[model samples]
Target chain A: MASKKNLVPRRDFIKTSALGLSALSIGLPLNSALATSCGSSGKDKLGIALVGLGNYSKGQLAPSLLETEHCYLSAIVTGTKEKEKEWAKKYNIPKGNIYNYENFDDIASNKDIDIVYIVLPNSMHAEFTIRAAKAGKHVICEKPMAVSVAECKAMIKACDDNNVKLSIGYRLQFDPYHKRIINLSKENTLGSINYVNADFAFTIGDPTQWRLKKDLAGGGALMDVGVYCIQACRYSFGQEPIALRAQAFNSGNEKFKEVNETITWQMEFPDGKISNSTTSYAMSVNSLFVSAQKGKAQLMPSYGYGGIKGFIKDEILEFPKFNQQQAQMDAFALNVKNNTDSIVPGEEGLKDMKVIEAIFKSLEQNGARILI
Target chain B: MASKKNLVPRRDFIKTSALGLSALSIGLPLNSALATSCGSSGKDKLGIALVGLGNYSKGQLAPSLLETEHCYLSAIVTGTKEKEKEWAKKYNIPKGNIYNYENFDDIASNKDIDIVYIVLPNSMHAEFTIRAAKAGKHVICEKPMAVSVAECKAMIKACDDNNVKLSIGYRLQFDPYHKRIINLSKENTLGSINYVNADFAFTIGDPTQWRLKKDLAGGGALMDVGVYCIQACRYSFGQEPIALRAQAFNSGNEKFKEVNETITWQMEFPDGKISNSTTSYAMSVNSLFVSAQKGKAQLMPSYGYGGIKGFIKDEILEFPKFNQQQAQMDAFALNVKNNTDSIVPGEEGLKDMKVIEAIFKSLEQNGARILI
Candidate 1:
């Protein structure tokens, strides 16, 4: 069981900001004040510790955390003591905050850390997140929440039991440009969304990486990048897909023996609109597009960590240098302190996993239509 | 065989103001100059005829011809006599030029017409185009060239044997913006084409339209709209796709089978880069996008008739409102008189048809990878 003392004090953080003052003037409750402050504040430095120093953690997460105002590097936890020491020295992190995997659970005893961001291999996300929850810390976990839907549910349950806020790192949901597009769609700027075309692919140069290993990364590009397209479809249309059909291809290689390198699928919404989507590790990368009767919304280089732009009706609406990972961390922090539901909560992640599972099932059956 | 004398010289009707001369002097060749100045200009207006008076011809081709320098509306061959009379009166056309389906072949002996534009159903395109060639007249046909590869080849042979130029109306090839995009791509403005994301789709409300009839429209949305994406991909990359994989869905009524409403596909280039592309009738219309290592070139609403805009690395490069259809017609006239190849000739249309055939085959096999 987790203690309340180690968990993020949402009300306290809210009281510490201008948002808290505004909330106080509005006669709102303390939790709502925290929520409003979370949305309003620019960036506040919150000490963050990253667990599982993988490639994404080092390349994307670390750089993004540095750019975030509401978060700063406080500590790191890794199974290898050498890596922990090397990273601590490189980032000039304090020695007291460093920990090996064996003593990772004791991280809750540390007083400086406000959040634990998990960027480990897929299978470890659930275990580490659950342990962090029990240690009375808010947790931000990377996508495909868990290896299985069952694992995701268990992790969510563990967090709830410990009374610690849990958020899945679906960074695009917090992306300002992407969020604006969603708002435009909801406003019927493009009329009704009658169709959607989404794709995410890249040529993977390394085969020995954990992403290619099914046990560690769960699945291939579909799990890694395809989930972004799926979430985009749902958010753009503001609904879950009612039915799905998919097809997959494998080039008969041991590198992708346990996962798929390519997947193409379609989803049918209740409004008779269908979304056509594709994702692959063996192809190129592109932005996802949504077309309605009036106009369209698209994110150029949509899923990348850099150079993301939003367009509507052939005009650019949002061009911001956004750090998706940092924005995600800040949002999670605010949600914890404010007792608010995460924009991309555990339930949303679970639903996306469900859609992913259904897609795999349809592909196995030769693209037979599967009702969601 | 059609005699050159039987063809109306399209240059005699030029109503050139001083503005027109200035426009022509700026390196833009007028279609009328090619007909009169290059060859022996005829004194009489060349009698022109339209075979199919559908939405496209009525809305685009007819209006463009009315503004043409050399072409004249001498005859109309339509299934609906009411529409024929309405069009004849609107254009002040002589009633002797009118003919129905039964009497259409008799116009071969009539001296009034020199050319016929076939704007019929996809399956009927080849039949009418070949018939017009045999009837001693030049032929202008709308795209998807024909329903199949065999049909396109046959149309090409018919026009060749008849000593006439068979032009496929690929209007985008004539649009200055698309041309600039292709030229820039070849010029390496965006570096070597590493990736492409092209899409064309629009919601179709009427399920019983010719587009929904598979036999008439060939496939579904891929035949009607996806052809644009395919052509754009070829032109933007400056090469043919070496391999392709495709997936399609029929979300509409299963019994109303003619065209697929949605399609997702990928094309692999020889340079080890692949394009992720999609087209759907169930969604809104979209433009073509190309991304290279250096930057990206994108056309929002790429296939629309007007208000087309192109972008390079977020800077607006071209915004043109000239009629794409009229530009195509003028170019075809120039090619005919100057003995030059068309920007979008029979060969290009044939290549696109070949790719379309492969996409259909791959879809039937559950998105099996096919080498183009």
Candidate 2:
């Protein structure tokens, strides 16, 4: 089992700066700084650009930017000209900010764009984020952070070398109810957590989505919804798993060879607490549960795009409506402006990816217990 | 993996008139008469003889009998004469029906005692149930049906030879909400079952309880609450597991020497569905979830000794409370009168015991996947 002492240390400079700045930032009242910064006359709003305008970018992210006060869509980079024109027209984005895939590097000359969010297919995340960082822009990348641990490491190194902040979009870290559950566990309100039962699944009828292509989506439901359960386990227990045992099922259809239809796994933490988790593309969705000595807390439809609810002792916890994507983007913007570290930084994503790799390996070996 | 074809055919004579007639003579209903006599009193109420005047017997079962119209506590068998006298007086049981453990067999001479309910510790279940059967009385045994597969087989054989009906107290089978989940899964209301997630755990603080003793309790949480989750998995999917993998933690507590304080396991069934289950004495209680292609149904607090509630999609299904122990006793009574096979027969308990054995074996081998 990996000890807490073995964990990678947080970046010393960012940690120090974060502590010092948080005290100063807390004193600034909400919306007061906003008027001084982003008035009609001043270049106050952070100029954000989206690279690789895929389904996630179109459906979730770009729409959220319309409501964000501190950030605005300043540019676009996509391979498809048709989509670029469509998005530009819909959002009233100027033609000067539009660029195709071939001329994306020239975005360095565009002074309007300050942050570049990479929403590409999985395999291209590292390439675009590194290039954007070198072009003097902070980066926000969608998760599974990168396809492998090595890619994650490389992406982190590239961002560090360019002196730009890097954050992975683990939006649940900002979700109010999820945060409440984590805080409750951290305070030992439920005593020491002993077990966690979690699952994420959905029947995906489409066989031609990017999720079915290993070269694009990295893996199957594990990369998509399963990672959320994994992240939830880590954040909820406030620890990393040291060992994992897993079993995976394939659809056996030729079309599904690149991705699994279902996978079930267990992760054991050092305190002898276990997290039992499963993800499937052919089953119904389920809640995420953390069972502790005192009681249990569950979030039904935990990682869904909307209306996440939390329950404790069979009673639902009430919290404000939180747009997780917006919260994540706001955090990224604040980190970029104030030179702060992200709560779910690149390193955290790397740790989850390592565990994900171990689970897949265990499944390949016929459900052997794999030590993390 | 055992095939469906490999299942032994039900012994015809055991299902024929002689066994049926013998069951009816003990006040259980015959299968042929079940439909017409759904709520009718075809036979006189069976006079039950309690073999152990312990906490579970006094607390759960005896109180349930007061409200039960079809069964009556006519006798008592206790090692302690004080308890025997106190219980007989409290329930208006006749002093002639009272017998010490040494004289329990003499109850056969008294025709009033039609059934003997054995609610003893692990090691004593087999002996008493077998003795009760030999005394020509129907037997109702509490769960973990026997300490081992051999012991379970012995109980079944003894009951078969004595021509006495034997029923295991798997009360959930009679529970309306649990039955609804099973029936809905069978009817494909949730579409084809793809996965099942279940857990039963509680913080067991008392180190001196009989449940902590391996000799008396058989195993820890797995033998206690886990049996219920296992039964739920089987009936919810209506199939036996073909293979299993398990891992357990001893938790560094000497009090749980012969059993595990926490255990996590997975079972693969014939239809490619996997049941991921966990049981622990260190964690709090949990629900059981069955995820299918269309939707999921969960029983929150699935195995609690209270009213079971079912959740499907967004709706909760609440059923009328029937005392599980009393309902089980009444089912045994009806089976005796009608001369029918038990819904939770000795063999069904034996099957679960076999799976439990396999889980322990797998845990011993460091979480190796084992075929059932």
Candidate 3:
């Protein structure tokens, strides 16, 4: 999106940044894995308020926020008043920074938090992101962007209209393993890629979870962890798939009554390369393999929340696992501070949304080749 | 296929086995790895001959035969005079045991050789297998069985008619890693499996190789290595897929004009478990993951000629890699001597052939699933 001119002033951004206290990300100088930083004393750090206190917030984002050099988790929006009190005391957030879901819109006048990180369920992404942006804060939404392409567009529009940057939480894009693999493709180290095999599947412990509901999740596995497979293909080739064929199977168990248990698909790029992938909520598998004219690369347990390792043939791509969430959060904050688009901008998530739509459509057609 | 009526006396079978020679297999009081022995004055060893000198024969079978206890590499059948001289000299075979393709039938009268191992191309499997059976020799034909189901049926009929056993060379059936994984499924160690992801893909170094030729290969990667993926799912579930949906993709490279570069499919069994697989000639990948209700199992570089490792959830299934071909050959010889069916009999091969046919049909129908 084109930059909105003479809108949110540079000084206002800094004023909000000065209010930042602590965060889940730690950017200090240049880390071997990525360019990270500790914000200069002249510039106040940006403060981010997480919209949901779900597992992701409690486990990853909240902890990483302390490490972020440019941003801190200064506030939170949660329906649980008990959680709000506990978090405010634990994280040392002032009472003024605490807000419940009903009072979230009132954040517009509060200058303490400059960014709203939406980590809610899939269906709630659009409403929260739009509200966050309209509240004069840059927005960072977790992936699948939204339940549909329309919601994604609306979020993008809301952020653009408010002159606030819109970023998506695609943490893997900042990960060293994937970044190196993408670099290999960019440099044609393996020649033209001929094939890609990516599968991400795991047994869901609770079938009654919100993720299994179509209205809440938009789809099944594809809307959740499957986005990593899509991201892998997209980043590896730096090209969109031109056509695709897909199929969804319900693992006849009663647990899968509400959604697909397994979904498999193959996408063909204009160049004739194929990306074949499978995602299931009823199986455990994580892998990514790329075959090119000159050589091959493979990574088992490819897409993980942590500890992702891989190899180019027999030689491994070695790097210590760093905090991916911290890297992603700090980068978003800097991008927002600079009034520039984040690398995982809303558009990146929007592209995946398009692919997701095509995949479901292909399955609806009973595995017909659906042109993108 | 039904068992053939008695031809060789039971005593004769025991006599041949008691004379067990340096074999491509040793199923005796199991030795450390190989307990190759030459027949003594009291026993008449089963003498086997190889019909091809391709990479598989040269790199795997030939070396393995030297270690076998029940059978020995007693004769040769090759169209190439150069390979005949080299192999005869290298393995110390008698001149009488050497025969060209033209004189292969004449071996029926030689009495020195009891088996014919056909390691030729896809199209040649049936002809050589039938010829060997007609010559009164047990036959081991490499997979895909034959170019067509009719040919597979013909080969089985010829072997049954001649009262000679026929085994398909599916070495993984003998590998301990796969056997254990299959056992886990059989024992319901992980509970009823809900999903499987299997893929085998390799870059074809030579575009003009027989494997890339339509008539020579019968098909592309699916017919070659993809069968491994199929075998994995079949054995893991111990059930034939009741239905399938598949799609074929071209690698877009001119080198793949004669056949598909990649073909991906999903097979559904009666219990609602799904096996999603991919086989590609244009990429390199090998993996198998099975997920059941209780837990998951994974194997990487899973279906290989050798060097396979895997884990059941967090626990690795540890076993030193051994010569799979030797075990396979040894087991086949023991089966023949016992007058019982080889574990991977002609019918086992015929079953996979049916699946292959269904997969192709599904692709031809634009991925409309075909019931098996």
TM-score of each: 0.79, 0.87, 0.86
TM-score of 2: 0.87
TM-score of chain A of each: 0.85, 0.86, 0.89
Report the CAPRI category for model 2.
acceptable
> Candidate 3's residue-wise lDDT over B1-372, tens digit each?
444433444643443444343121434332211112111112245777998889988898999999988778888888888998899999999998999889888775555666789999998999999998876678899988987888989999998766678899999988988898889877888888777878898878877889989888889999998888888899988888899998888746877877788888899986667888888876777888887778778888798877787788778887886888989888888776666667898988888888898998888898987988
Off by over 4 Å in 2: A1-42, B1-43
Candidate 3 lDDT over A28-120, as tens digits, reads 222211111111223457888999998999999999999998899989999997898889988999998998889999776565677899999
Judged by whole-model lDDT over C-alpha atoms, candidate 3 comes out at 0.80
Off by over 4 Å in 3: A2-43, A187-191, A292-300, A312-321, B1-43, B81-83, B92-96, B187-189, B292-296, B315-321
For candidate 1, give the lDDT of residue A70. 65
Better of 1 and 3 by TM-score: 3
How many Å off is the CA of A168 in candidate 1? 1.1
State the C-alpha lDDT per candidate.
Answer: 0.74, 0.77, 0.80
Q: What lDDT is reached at residue B4 by model 1?
A: 42
Candidate number with the higher TM-score (1 or 2)? 2
Sort the candidates on lDDT, descending order.
Answer: 3, 2, 1
